[model samples]
Target: MAQGIRVLHVLGNTQLGGAESRVMDLYRHMDRERVRFDFLVHTEKEGHFDKEIKELGGQIFCVPRFRLYNFFSYRKAVKNFFEGHREFQAVQGHITSTASIYLPIAKKAGIPVTIAHARSAGVDKGIKGKMTRWMRRNLSKKADYLFTCSELAGISVFGEKAVREGKTIFIPNAIDCRLFAYNEKKRMELRRKLGIEDKYVIGHVGRFHYAKNHEYLLHIFAELCKKEKLNEDLKNKKSFVLLLLGEGSGMEGARALAEELGIADRVYFLGNRDNIYDYYQAMDYFVYPSRYEGLPGTMVEAQASGLKCVMSDTICREVAVTELVHTMDIRADAALWADYIRETADYQRKSHVEEMQKAGFDVNGQAERMMAFYENGNFDA
Candidate 1:
């Protein structure tokens, strides 16, 4: 029976990102007796989801990092792991940027079902990035199933022709919506704890990376500070603070930029909190100026928390499931973002739990749907 089948999910470290968070939400909601999940991550270090994954009866296995310099060694490691574990019912890979490398290894190991998933709509530029793209394009042919978070993401990883021919399965980046729904008690409590009770809080939940446009975000916040100083109605009031949540390779650079811009004191870098829902509740506005995205789960959570969201137009429109979201061009100057934020800063919070459920982004429903998909080994639905 498919009830006790185990699935292997391959990816980078299981950290706190959109892709990681969505998978965890599904894992938490899935019926454990019907389906089980195991992880094959690249890093040896324990991640934010490691303890929870273990407590849920899932095993964590690690392999050496995949690199062009160590191609032979990486391949041997993957081959050995798959050969040793012949019991995995299926292997689903979430590292779209490099799925071509590992999916072929899984296929060669005789895995019956091989799934390649796309999670982002953009890639880095330059020679190295071009080589990665070429590798992905050639190696992605080994997968039996193609999965993507959005149409643009599907096109980015698997060519437009492939997506047009119905070759990819679209999966919404679902979440536990009710947990992030507007909560006045949580808002007041978190605000008090964070010592931001009387301040205008502008929140953003994303890694500090070039793709997220953190440099531009700092400029916008600096402009907002300048504007606040000039407003006669806010002369004695404290300036709005920018709350940055999450960490990444660009963390040091982002902090340096904030300091150089003279806004270091006004920006808080809260790195990877377990209780992200409370941060959402405490925020008054959510700002995201990413260069591009597949389908951001953070924007969904922000709306679920009833925060007025301002995001880049490059992000897929499918994420705007609620009226709280607003999009602006990524090329627009920081002054424009400041003006828009100041203009829309006083909106009220309301419950959007039903709206999220109606949009088919509820984790419980998606978890069941995905379980059925794994059991049937079909993408017809």
Candidate 2:
């Protein structure tokens, strides 16, 4: 048997965030004999990714989290990199935080290859944006390759510089279709258990943060409930329920908004669930109203789960791999989303099963791609 390529993945933390989850997904399925994986995480608190990484026969090296402008942390990372340089053939940084801070260190360590992967749109506009752009311009040059989940994310960070330089590659986020496939029996069972078996459930699975626009989702649901109560025909024909799965700092505010709008009873807050795919199965329709995203894994998971999705325009187009998904504007307008929810509820969309199969987003395919990148510097551009 041929020897496996060794890869060291450096990430901000092991938290159950998008980038962390993507790395886990890749690690879990990569061919054991083709690519061996390890992780360098920056966090004082051990996170959910730790166990999964260990289970996959990978090692985790924890480093102090680097605050912006913290030269000391950079020096520490540099020291750590030199101490552990011999174990891996290449180092891959998964998001901007790691890429901006560690790419230079990895380059200096003389790793065979250093990859900086862009996983989101640039930082918010203003001072932070300016600083981030400057960092990317200077720090990114050290990376042998730049990988982005979408072209939009690449342009948002690197702008014309990436196109002119010709180093950025777009690799859309892939999900395990088998894990998220349509399971009618499971859907029915889960819906019955949630006591929303008869209601039209509109689902949103994500951390409750500003980017997710949960406040707007509450207002949208409120508007739909009011409309259902006022219009006798619509009321008699349809009733709606909301399933919010995930937790974050914004949870209390979102809960308060639901109460203020008097729709608390209609919304279910299932916080920080491990089996998120089951919640997707229980829903009638999926909605992602994020303000901005590189590519939402929930959106891809929803499509794989065979739920028709209604998302915001700011979400990366890479997640909309099939026609079953729909996009909305990001103005946080309640009435507009309510209208869309109603229209989407009425439309009979095709199941995404075949589409997901055709797309080849299953874990095996995704792992193969990452293995190729690690072993031969081959990535689908």
Candidate 3:
């Protein structure tokens, strides 16, 4: 083993989602002296983080697009693995497909350490979810280490037979606090720029998807609007507005739903922007009504930004480190979620801000931990 370790991180895409964001965060802050990082992405299409990764001095390898079961893809990926094998001390695969496809090759390449990282509970309903679980159970054991973002996610894949007695390790997503620190000036500026004034902003940041449950969020917001209209106390004290960030396949559907609800005027769909943190500053409350998660990075970022969060209980428990966050059942009625939103919208929360900073969910600490893990090969088994 050498004094400095070289690690190759393999992911299915380079998009600015939770998994990709975390990978970039780690790369940006990891100890340069102790660990060197590079990437392998399956897509040839450029992603939002590509330029940033290159600027950080990490190499990017592009693999051809192929179905996970495609033999040609495996052959090409294996060849690529051999080409970079000598340069990397270890290889870490970030998603199920990547893990299933590359772990065997890395093992054969005689890499000192091969890690299979499970970043989500598995994809939502479809043949895709079934195939991902099958791969996790059948192929994940090839790696020297199995890592998951949360205990729930690990169990969902490995089941009681494999991980209940402690076979896999849990490392919740880490956040860079400095990046989301409370910027009073920036918050005001963003609010002015967005033309959001004299209103309470409820924010949700994620790609539109079934798992994210954006339909439920719209329903909840509509309920809140109606409640405010009827309740004198609520009507006089505060106004409600929704801020939706990110774009995806379900985006147009989501926009249509908002229009159907007749609250389209009150909702702002900012699409995708590079300065998401700025939007966080302008938000008054954060809502994450996800049906499932591997530990959401947005939850951490929202809490770090000092916004009181109302998330689905299932996902909120994974991020139970903060008191500023509240949760309800994923199947909770719209009325219940609406009540929660109205109650917390006007509440002042300075104590929660202090708590997040104390917890070290901040970026620098997370980077140090990752750097140490790469340098020493210690996974706390």
Candidate 4:
């Protein structure tokens, strides 16, 4: 018999995404001899973490994406998997859109724990978004545990009543704080390498999805360039630059919009990166005008790196682990957003490891809490 307590995590893929990153952080810190994780991702394409997961002694299973017209086939696939494989102590549904269908199947198949882990507060627009919200309507009732990373996410997916009645558990999308902690030497080195040593660097780290509001971010950059009085050194037309990190369908759209807005020269799409934490060191400020989020780990990463962040109010206020984070409505004008970033650009930067840990956003502490739950099915998160 295998000695490790095996837990299965469901996600879109092992890609460098918010939920995937958080789970990987937890997995990295676990007592692997006593507990291990296996993944059930929706894609057949290999993911960023696939090699590492295998090396760490974990399994990966794949299923085709679920569609309304193929509900029967999807349900059959899930049922067949759970009925045949009985190794999992728990099935964690990070992709909660289909949890209402899968968790009950896991429970019926004798899995001791079923978790609906809501990682985002909003969905895609139009038909896709409507379908997703419909699918998640009964997710809370289907799971033994309703796990959410933020208050807004909990209320949004699990329903306000379930959250209010104390049925929902708050799990900070914790991270390795030490990795992102500020270092002046590293900052200077990266700035010089990127040739932005003298320019004011505003940053963002996320895929160029509809929710990330890339177009609005560009508009903000254009506005920021117009505000010469904000800083003397950066008052030159070319002194302020925006560094966009991550790739997606919206990337070309963002680039085109940058050109249309006449700020193409100032915007650099760095694409997806392995050393993302370093960019935080090089940046003077961070802006995330997202339409919605669960609990963005980048906000924690930004705070850990001591970068002042101005994000949309749609993000849960709980991510404000420190006073470094400020919010604005999504409806607000780009000029107003620029003013906030420019006004706060004068603050000193420092390490926030202590603050991050104090707010329970550090991985080490939560790893213990999660390990205890998986080892003996004791629930505390």
Candidate 5:
């Protein structure tokens, strides 16, 4: 028999993405003696966090990727999984695209609580995006509780009334604020280690994807490098460094674009980093040009680490918990973003941990509330 209340988190994978990272932070912070988190991921291949999760005594279950044609088969897979392992006290569906299908099944299988969590404010482009939108159209009707990372995400997935009427629970993407607090020693050490002590390191943390807007990010970096070439005091393009942290199918494309722009040597692609917070300390500036997001946790981490961030206006405004982050339109010219970074890069870096904690983006407090959520239906109460 299980020793604690088991909460099943349905995700695409336990990879190092925004949602995955945020959840993993909460898992590490939560009191495991009272609450334990298990994963029901869509992919069979082991994820980056699999080993850590197992070490923490959480079970991992896999199911096939759900396509529209395999709808019934996917339902069967979820049903069979629940039938064999009915230990879950609550099922929190992070993948809202299929939450409509799975949450109801979990409820039918005698799970007392079903949570449909909306973690993304936008969808992918083209046919797949259409499929995602179609699948989650009625997700709000299926789950016992509706949770959203941001108001934009709630309105997008659960409709405007659900959000406006306060039917949805707003769960900010919380992090371990202390981990990301500014440390001058770590900054100097890592910068020296990377041979970028003299360089203005521009950092970005996210997988290369259409939503992440890596192409736009590269273009902005290229523009910034061009500015460096013209600046007599800034020396040369070598003085500017771009460190992209994350990996995906779009990595090669970003690399090729960097080469085409003649800044290949200036860009470093650090794939799936475990010490991502340390990298934030080493960074002088953080830049995120994503097309959309559900209150990106990276922004909070960057702010906590005392790095000034230039954000895309498309993301939810809820993430600007600190005054360090400034928003610009994704449709704006790359030079405009470059101009902003150049003008604002010199601000004194100081940890915004207090602001993050006050804004409720700190993970420790939320983890306790989450434990209560799984144990009882009135999570907020």
Candidate 6:
């Protein structure tokens, strides 16, 4: 007999992105006895979450990447895997664009609960994305439950009618607020260790990608540096620092841009950090200029850490769990972004953990809610 009811999750890879991180947060807070998570990652290679998944008693399975050329093998792998392990209470797919392909297979295999979760608000451009979206929309009819991180995400993947008709459920991407809570002593200590004392630190935590708009961020930071240099009358005008975390394919481009702008010395690329909470504490401001999103989780963490945040207007306003977030249009010039950054950098820091709780983003409560759903074998309730 099985130890407990296991929920199967499907994803492209276990990379440290917003969706992956949010799911990991939920995994860490779940009750293992009542509900457990098993992963079916497409990538054959190990990921950042692989070790932790094993440590937490979760099983990880892999299938070949879904491509037109290998369509038969992909379907065969899914069929065989589900057949061999016929113990899943629910099969939840995180890659919304491709959920249609897998959820139907799970459904045909007699899995009781098939969930299609939409984590992003936008899709890639060109024929492939269009085809993927078309396939996802047609195939998503197999899912018993439709979940999305935000209303925008719901509309993007499941269609506006499904969202308006109450077919899609909006689940907040929650986090452990206490871990990101502001700490003055920690700020001082970390700043001293990094030699960032008396400096105006601007921080961003996301993969260096086209969607993240890292190039635009570098331009704006360059503008900020230029403006700061021209202003000799400003008080306490110490040096400036830009702290970037996370790694991706665009990292080389971002680094080159920083060097070209002659601001590479002030820009610190601290990739894939384990102590992200402490880094948040060390920041005076948080900058997120993502092109589009369902709801970026890092903004909430930034708010919890009491960092004054300047995010792009492309994100959902629902992400503003606290008053610290200021959203500006992505179409705005780099000088405008720099002006906003300079204007907001000196705001006071305070714990917004309680506000995050009130906004229904406290991980502990959300975890319990999900646990109950899993144990009850229904989300319709």
TM-score of each: 0.96, 0.91, 0.92, 0.96, 0.96, 0.95
- Write the number of the candidate with greater lDDT, choosing between 3 and 6: 6
Residue-level lDDT tens digits of model 6 in 189-291:
9999989988889899999867788999999899989998754443488667899999999999998999999999999998998779999999988989889
Clashing pairs in 4: none
lDDT of each: 0.86, 0.76, 0.77, 0.89, 0.89, 0.86
lDDT of 3: 0.77
Can you write out model 1's per-residue Cα lDDT over 1-381, one digit (the tens) per residue? 466778899989889877888888999998888889999999998898999999988999999987778888988898899888877778989876667777777777778888988888887767766866777785447689988899988888888988999998889999999899899999999889989888889999998766798888899999999898654443246569889999999999999999998899989999999899989988888999999788899988888888899999999988998888899987888999989888777656797888988898888888878888888975332
Task: Give the poorly placed runs of model 6, Cα more than 4 Å off.
Answer: 1-3, 230-235, 377-381
Pairs in steric clash, model 5: none
TM-score attained by model 1: 0.96
Cα lDDT of model 4 by residue, 127-231, tens digit = 999989998888888999999999899988999999999999898999999999998988999999988988889999999899899888899999988785545
Q: Where is the poorest 10-residue window by lDDT in model 5?
A: 229-238
Q: Which ten residues in a row have the lowest lDDT in candidate 1?
A: 230-239
Model 4 spans > 4 angstroms off: 1-3, 233-238, 379-381
Q: Give the TM-score of candidate 6.
A: 0.95
Residue 139 CA displacement from its true place in model 1, Å:
4.8
lDDT of 3 at 177: 66
Q: Native-vs-model 6 lDDT?
A: 0.86
Q: What is the lDDT of residue 284 in candidate 6?
A: 86
lDDT digits (tens) for residues 1-381 of candidate 5? 234898999999998888888889999988798889999999999899999999998989999999889989999999999888888899999999989888998899899889999988899999999988888888888998999999999987898888889989999899999999999999999999998988989999998888899999999999999898654443343478999999999999999999999999999998987888899988988999999888888899999998989999999999887789899999999999998888776777799999999999989888877877776665652
